[model samples]
Target: MSSGDFSLGDFVQRALPLAILGLALIGAPLLIFEPEGLPRMRALSKELAQVKAENVELTRDVAHLRAEVLDLKDNPTAVERIARGKLGLVRKSEVVFQFGKGR
Candidate 1:
């Protein structure tokens, strides 16, 4: 309590505000601009958005593939189309035509 004595209570009263202010000064910019803070959050948000878009596209592709699979399983015409296009299969009664030069 003497005028020349350093006191814990007095130090806390004076230094706490400065410490709090300094921390805020250092922390506010991190919240706004630092790569591990706001910037990283924004990057993650952008990545999530991209992943969601890709998921939608993949969902559509999966649906289309499923429908095609069902068609190939049940629709004779679809089976024939795939066989002719992918496997080069022909009906027994169909004539084979070759116009290109043989390798």
Candidate 2:
């Protein structure tokens, strides 16, 4: 066909594919990288990082408590003091008296 004889059918066929491609290009970024999509991923990443940090802190605390437990186990004086106060044990020379509001 001649350039001046461009028909509506030919224009629509060319324009439809271009319109669909344009819409796909525009919508792809919104679907993949828009705030609604990316913000949740970013928030999850931050939460994962915080949870990892808390895990590390809890691990350190557990290690410290384990060390303290080992120290108490190895020390007789510490064990004796804990037993005397917590278990209410007394030596042979110590006087045992009960003078309290309940008694």
Candidate 3:
């Protein structure tokens, strides 16, 4: 009860068990409430963050596509250029020629 009666060994014996019990109490949440552990939680959190980042990137891409669609609707030249490049279209007077390298 008194410090005078407690030897160093006695003090350590009492303190060590109390310290272990305190650590166990502090660790209970990390053991039970967490699905796996701190590492698993960190990995899941990182995955969620990456997904959210990719979602943001995809949303930006959609916005860019919408702007391009609006531009194509308002500009006939842009539509023609896209069609000419992507679909290989040509005007009535345009000549189509193919030269083979094996000649």
lDDT of each: 0.94, 0.91, 0.91
How much is the lDDT of residue 29 in candidate 1?
Answer: 89
Please give the lDDT score at residue 15 for candidate 1: 100
Native-to-model Cα distance after best TM-score fit, residue 11 in candidate 2, in Å? 15
lDDT of 3 at 48: 100
- Candidate 1 Cα misplacement greater than 4 A, ranges: 1-18, 101-103
lDDT by residue for model 3 (78-101), tens: 999998999999989999998889
Candidate 3: misplaced stretches above 4 Å? 1-35
TM-score versus the correct structure, for each prediction: 0.71, 0.54, 0.63
Ranked candidates (lDDT, high to low): 1, 3, 2
Model 2, clash count? 0
For residues 1-103, what per-residue lDDT tens digits would candidate 2 score against the true structure? 8888989999999999999999999998898787778788899899999999999999999999998799798998888888899999988899988988874
**Candidate 2: clashing pairs of residues:** none
- The model with the greatest lDDT is 1
Lowest summed lDDT window (length 10), candidate 2:
31-40
In model 2, state the lDDT of residue 9.
99
